[model samples]
Target chain A: MEKKNTQQEIEEEIKSKGKDNIIKKIFSWILKNVKFLLIPASRLEELSIRQIEYEKKISKRKFIRRMKSTLTIFGMLLIFFIVTIAVFAPWFSPYTFDVLVGIAPGNYDPPSPAHLLGQGRLGRDILGRIIYGARASLTIALPSILFSLIFGVIFGVIAGFYGGWADSIIMRIMDILLAFPGLILAMVFIAMWGQHMEYIMLAYGIIGVPYYSRLIRSSVVQSRDLPYVQAAKVTGAGNWRIMFKHILPNCIQPVIISFTFDIGGIILSLAGLAFLGFSDPQLIEWGNDIADARLHLYEAPWGAFWPGFMILLAVLGFMLLGDGLRDALDPRLRNIYGAKKKKRKKGKKEENDSYEKK
Target chain B: MTLIEEKTEDSDRDPEVILSVRNLRTYYPVLGGLFRRKIAEVKAVDGVTFNLYNKETLGLVGESGCGKTTIGNTILNLVSAKSGEIYYKGVRIDNNFTNDLRKKIQMVFQDPDASLNPRWKIVNIIGEPLRILERMKKTREIRKRVLELLETVSMKMEHLDRYPHEFSGGQKQRIIIARALACNPEIIILDEPTSALDVSVQAQILNLLKDLQRKFNLSLLFITHDLSVVQHVADRIAVMYLGKFVETGTIEEVFYNPTHPYTRALLSARPTFDPTTKTSRVILEGDVPSPINPPSGCPFHPRCPKYLEQGKSMACSEDVPKKIHLGGEHYIWCNQTK
Candidate 1:
């Protein structure tokens, strides 16, 4: 049976792509040959789905066992609302992000049907600016966090896998970077390079590296000694394969959990930097809206209020989502809320099944 | 320091030595405080010497810290030897041996769950060695070889798509052994391969290992603390204590006519199946001493029964004992034998 299976596999693999373009043929061939790489990844995805199902079952039995708790539901709705506004901002508002509405610059308008949420000090539509502001905040925070995570994991894996002099040097550099407060260091980078959206993002990305690297390093140190890694070494794998293939995959869980929380924090800080004029003045961000309303504090309090409210809502949604992820991912907290007796019986049944299968 | 003469089972056949070690020592430094000063040293595998012959299973039995695992790791060069010489088929392997040697010497770790990569499917985990050492490219060929190996370990082809976590401990161990046998290695170091397994499954794995070894003529360095388990699988036994080999002999010599006091204690500790036989348990006086600051002269002298029986003589504390041959390959490190 095994022989026939292998024969069928070989035949399928060797099948030709008829009359295709040279590039198309090459792409198909590359894709076919890369089956070895794809199978493991697909299997990994399948295993992770099993893991998520297991976690869902555990978390359901424990605290707030519902598939979607009230808090999670609210958070999801808020995120959905924000994303909708960002995606269809033009449809929601009569004016563009920077264009004036109701009146010219240096004028303020209160809530009205034609221009809801009133007008900014520049007479631009507050609702439109707020919608576009969500786009800007999300784009900056997500990419910067991604940049930091990629670089952090690389440095951390290298430092953790090849200890001794390499670990010492990499950790020492991280220490020096960590010594300065992240926000202040980001401000320093903004000061060095003229203040712009990209520079602010670059600064945030640089500052985020040490935090993630340190997090990844600690986890890596614990996992590097696991017998699987030792087994990989015994198989004659080099340092690169051991670090990337074996160690990095296991170190990603805690990093992902931290990344969720860090995204909220980065959004808050990005708004703060813009408020402090570290970002380009021309960019229509929530922080820029609040900064513009500073002179009209008493006359147009609603100008700052709308933008401030959106920032609060966005940060709260992310924080709630982060908390939910932590609860789901952490095993100790996983089995806390459902009927203890029922869950224990189920667990016992599963254990027996595993035993019987063996 | 005169070397003890080693005897093979069939001396007339000009027995081939697959692996040999000379004065092997591995010490770890203990760093203290800021500036990282060398505060102390851990003599994990201090001055161990032995040889493994072709197609023979050499069991290394010892207590937890006696460095049995360390010796196994050192042989595979996983843990670097501080000062020693290792020869594989009379070819010296130092820090810079060619990668092909890795295919010749594979290892099966103790804990099956920890040994197999949890994120990987059975195919990748087992085919990894073939990919690295043999540089086999085609996925079909790798999959076919993986299936054959799994079958050798008594697993089916359907298991190829499953992840490590999906399998039971015994099945995971089968995958690990399959991985070790992937390159068709000449020698495999089974480092307590069955310690973490259930009693029934342990037997199954041992039998599988024996069958594969016989089929491939593979030499095995079986390291374990359980004497009974090793007895079933090992052809020769080396009794270790406090990071040194105290007794070396064939299974019959070690079990029937045990030489070293440590060996006797280890044997007595094994619970006999026939409980009505009424055998006296030779429990030692104290624990195995710390390897950091071992006893002067003889490392085992502090806990040695013979030393206590002889009134703790000054000679036992002052001088190291020489290796004394009993019969065949049996040798003991004791002053009485000398």
Candidate 2:
């Protein structure tokens, strides 16, 4: 009875004051529903329990099953190995990449006890340079790919969602960017911005935007007219909200699969740029080491071989991871695998039942 | 108490018309050539008009590409009408729908799989309308309201945090219904809501729709290609052929005395289980003509059985048919029958 009287009083107060002041009315309504504003302890416990159950269910989903493939595990291990080497480069490397240990003509020494992976033309320890090179390669590639993804998704969603003059204009611009060979475009960007590491990364990043944008654009276009998007519109969601919140999540799987592949591709391209003498000579990059070893390839093949091998390993690891991710992320493929597993289990159960009857 | 009595008396005397559509037309342009010029226009919806009374289910039935879905979309403003006026409770809302108007009107789309965002949980999907239209910011309030809606649709609490893919087709439709009911919408446009479900599930959904209608006094614009489903739920029926409505009447009037030849052919197309009764099926010859270059005069004249029976007269080929009133609230557009 007391609670009812207080509620009625608050309601009456709001009715009298709300006619003149909207803010005061809102405040009074909030006060009236204060219990709802601060959730009760019982509700909090229930929500936490629900969340834990949800997480447990999610972990056992098809994606997890697909991730358990042998090749995917190998790819993950390979990436972990490279990342560990990169992180511990300073502690692990026996000599600085820039230091020349051997004297004069003997600087181009073969593989020895002192320098495990032989020496470059400049007599720098190949293993030490390769370890440090992992850091430089990742720093450039990861951030650049992320940059491309952000801008590409923005442009693609806008072009595909609005889809009229905006679609034509943005897509044509992307087409123009794609018309230029990727290397040539990167070179042009590097030319304009100078040969600094940041400029090189920016060039690589910009060169990649067209591919990501086109990929996201096609997916966005296909999903934009889907009934769910229309339902969101009918529910009074704005164009921006519909694009980012509803449509983007559905169309982003292809973009995610493409992202992993592009990391390796960008790393290779950076090495190519270095090989073409666009990179700084002072930098202890894999591509720079390979470039330095090119002259001594005939006498000591190990110099060029080590750096080339590291690039190959890095690229192969990323490619394998990308392939695995593509298979895992595709719901159709995941379901197919799941069905096969179920069928096998059913077959085994039937065989066991028959054996017991026999 | 007197105000409530007076409102009931008013309603008893005359049924209130909640939504009125006047001469609605929606066209899609086909672009071609180097410069992407508008080559031709597909008349998806050409001049459709109808009124939906409060607390009544108005079923809009048609064959594929006959503008049934287009009409629903035009009312929702998802598709811009080429020329039309849509008045919601006497105020025109075709191109000018306020947030309040939007809150009162919602849609349940066809294809349970396609209608839901596969990525979203049932709670978020059902709570979306409340968050957007009502500005209900508190999570607890929204969840409580969502729970109420789920119960209204007969869905369980365990389905809340699960994704759409986790549910069967029927359950997904129920969740969609819960989403549509989140804001307590006065009118719901159901575009073939059960064409994708099994027959048993279809019957269950129809019963749920009927129950929800009585509970909330909702005006439903149920669009479907299936006539039996329409017969089970609709209070009134509008039969569409090509891009125009061929007939509109109460369910008994339309079902019992289908005046228009197109409506008769459509009614006769419904399959019957009784083998003893020999019913002459009105098989529509040829196919629905392309809406891009629809025949002159009556759009249905090309394949209309009456037109063929009357020797393909020039009158049927040259003049557009006018509406003929066959007594109270029942009318059809057919020159030959009149």
Candidate 3:
């Protein structure tokens, strides 16, 4: 019986045109209907679709409690301010971290005008170092975390899909890499590679790989089992296509969350390495400033406070963002929120069935 | 005296068959780490074969884990088969031809939520394969075709750009059907497509599937655990048990005068709407045995009501009964057939 359908399928294929035409048709429709294409334009004008996808739905009263538990407006603004300062450090601070702009190479008196946070051990402007350090820390952490995500996602994808000898080999390597504590491993690699910005990034990437690999690997395992993956396979999508197209999209949740934490961790680890006297002093980073200010902290407490405050804000911001994302993207949490504004109406038949059943 | 008299079996059905399987087997081995020792093999589909003729819906009905799903998956090569020869268009199907052969075949999965990728907009979900395999017209053409497909499936043109989450469960399934129809496939193997839906949604999807099948003249390999569903769709029925088919015949023959012992028990289990002729609700005692170490004789002999040993089936539980052909194409694998 399966034979006859093949004839009909062939005939239809021959008559109307090939699959390419069908695909073209869909694309054209989107182009023509571009106005509605943006969330509201489509036929799915159901109330749920109109809502911003990741917003958390909570009881109106309970909503206040949720916001209360997370970072407040002041904290968020502080984080944003710190990030902006770091991004615009060149414009914000006329002096580089090491550039002792003005103290006339003499009078390192009490906190006063001109030098806002005063000078440190090398008589470098403390304000200059703190602002420059934000730039230094962000560049280092963002790039380092990015490398980690890239290699980790690649390794994780391979391990999750193959699941046999290849999986064993890759996982064992991750286990070996994971044996050393993340900070210790980063320190060792930085020491071996010799301390350049690139070397530090390399160190952070290597050390962070195992965490993302394990995370993405687990996500891939779950995603591979979703019926859509199997459906893709039955429809003749190859292994690579299935891995990238079907399985990989679902793994984005954890990878995104880990990226937030990786940035924070990278900042701490890089600073810790710098404080341990590994970082080149010429770099004039957050950690180096903290180290320089340690001796005269009581006298020039401003030196310690600015650098410490900036570090706290950057780390806290990424974390809060990640926490907000976790609550929104996690399926269980989204279901709880159920978009309170509107409920979908049942079709006539469905309404009638319920009516009859009632 | 046979429930079905001898005269009617031999006269129906054509001699020519479209696709036929001999001894099909698909066993998934449960394993552990490192050395990867095979702990136990779940014989999801074991030693099953039946011919599928053209232009007919063959309902492969059985309880869950009875291997009806495995049979469909194996046929489509979704799950790797331990040993099976799936022929397509008189050609033996291996992994190589499986890709090209897929255009002719498609499957609608059980869960609409799990089956449709949430990230992909409706257009990509339907138009992706057109970009992959077939060489076709411009982007404008494919877009129009998709809208036409949406219209054909009773969906609006406006739904093209939205994501899967925007639609209701029924709409999701309709989009899934639109996607399946995109390849313009000849055979659609619906694996419990309606089971995950509400009754009202279920009726609509079923009706849509029927309408599409008739309109397009598509062949369907409808795999379902629900016996009531296949009645309207399948022209023929193949009742599966523990990875093997116990009965294969016309729908009328299987439902009206079910010959195989297991088939009869299953039929007996479905409550009759007729208030006058009551069914006893004969429960098949005990859980389905693990596929690893199945019973010695007939797999269903432990639960068979009409079974007799002759020392061949139940006695020493040694010799297994072969599939007995009782005229026409009404075949049954049971010791009592003789």
Candidate 4:
């Protein structure tokens, strides 16, 4: 009767409060009732599972913090600088990329105070062209990669989730696309359609679809039979709902990681396409600048060097960031870097102690 | 007053039969060798038949691979039935593709952890069926119902915001139970609901289930290999062997006086708590035969104690035994009957 009375009293008290207050009271009550003395076995198991999750989250944060590798940092800075220069192109460059503004003829000049990266054969400012070229490279890479990702993920998830004739037919089509070398296929696409920014991006995105689709397909296949997927089906969730809601979230991590690296690869491919004269001649692009300076490669080395250097820097930055992301994302691999850092810290502490003793 | 006694007023009164299954067979093609050809068919649930009364828990007890879970899933239409007739409230729903059956019947899986979506909050997890089937559109209405369900399973309303991983196995099961009850289901198929839980937690969940069953007046199809777990809760028990029901009866009829040799063997295998009473455990010789190629005559004849005792009679090996009724709902499938 006393137990019943107290319970009734608590319920009445809880009811008196608003919903938020009731939630607070309930939380407090639970915290009070969690018996530490007699820890249940299931509770212990739950604690360990929670512990593993907590450790994973903490390790992930720590991994991300420690992921600032020298090359990754350098790459990030380079990308950041390039993007900044691209955004403020007019302010950063002294002269327009197309206009001949140099004091020398043949439009090619050696290094001077008035012009920073010397001058191209066309007399267009090399530094200005490179700054403006960053815009073209980034615009082509980011949007095309996003386009490919969206299409790839959709096709792959659908194909993998609904395996059978769908799987075989879709995979065979992708295989046909994959059979052609990426650059060669891009060239073929350029030939069929007139070479333009849109055409190049479409060609690049089309070729990229096969690779991402295959990656996402394998992941979807693995996660498709995970018990939660079956649970969702049992709950009467539609096939599309199950594919998007249940399976996609679980299988997208590795795909996202690979996507970063693919960005760098896409940038390189775009540059190659531009170098092959696929882009508009009026556009101030890195590969086009490099191609323009090719005739004067021996006469003035500075013309080719600047644009080529920028391309290398951009690619290296993207690749390094991708590598760092890979190391940071996976806990097991992250631990290797973590262990080395911890060892270095320990060694430094030991040296400090010896110095104090001396 | 105790919840059990409070509800026992109508214990003797016969409840209406809510769901019935007749000769349900679920088979899977066993592909083998390099070419992935269909070598043979494994009859997982071969011709199993039973009736579940309203507010009654019919325990389907069996060995590991004896098709108890398969039977439950087949009834729920999770696995396509090879052949059978299933009636829910007298409607022939043999091959149902609609959501009406899902609304009527909800199932709780064996593994609580696996059964729940790890990424989803308790509200969405439990509210999914309500929104999908019941069309409970308003968030306020859904929240109210979800809270009521949580309370029904002895969980707090605050638990609504939490994920499945945040709770213990017992608590996760309570959430699953809450989800099962969200639709106000007529029948809840518990597929080894307590097998994955701790022994103490198992008792709590069982008690919770019993209370919920009585409160909602819902029928239960409890599937489990562990006989003792169902012994207390089930009004009637069915013992299965090699994809077939060897024996079935009321709890007392099955527990106290099991007629089938397989049932007797199963009963003996259940460890006793009493030190005083002695029971020579019925150790049946040889492993349970594969379901792909079940014995020609009686499935249990090869491992039957009576068959060996009666000098391996030709009747035991050559002829199939019809169900022999030993008075008042107690039926056994065997050649020799006392």
Candidate 4 or 3, higher lDDT: 4
| lDDT of candidate 3 over A118-213, digit per residue (tens) | 766656677777887877888888887888788988899999988878888999999998887766766777678777788777777787888888
Local distance difference test values of all predictions, in order: 0.79, 0.82, 0.72, 0.79
Per-residue lDDT of candidate 3, residues B1-338 (tens digit): 11122332221233345555556888988886767788888878887777777777889998888898888787777776777566666677745554557777788888998888876767777776665645445787778878988998888765776667757799888888887888788878888888889888888888898899889878888898778888877888899888777898888888888888788889888867887986766666777887877776667776665544343344325446566776566788776645
- Per residue, candidate 1 scores C-alpha lDDT tens digits across A9-41 of 666656753445699978878886576566665
Looking at model 2, the pairs that clash are none
DockQ of 1: 0.49
Q: After superposition, how far is residue A164 of candidate 3 from its true place, in Å?
A: 1.5
Give the distance in Å from residue A147's predicted Cα in candidate 3 to where it truly belongs.
Answer: 1.0
Q: Is the docking of candidate 4 incorrect, acceptable, medium or high quality?
A: acceptable
* TM-scores for every candidate against the unseen true structure: 0.80, 0.82, 0.81, 0.79
Candidate No. with top DockQ:
1
Provide the lowest-lDDT 10-residue window in model 4 chain A. A48-57
**Runs in model 3 with CA error above 4 Å?**
A1-90, A96-98, A101-110, A182-193, A320-358, B1-16, B32-34, B135-141, B280-283, B308-316
lDDT of 1 at B190: 91
Taking all chains together, the TM-score of candidate 1 against the true structure is: 0.80
> For every candidate structure, what is the RMSD over all alpha carbons to the true structure, in angstroms?
8.4, 10.5, 9.4, 10.2
The DockQ values of the predictions, listed in order, are 0.49, 0.45, 0.28, 0.23
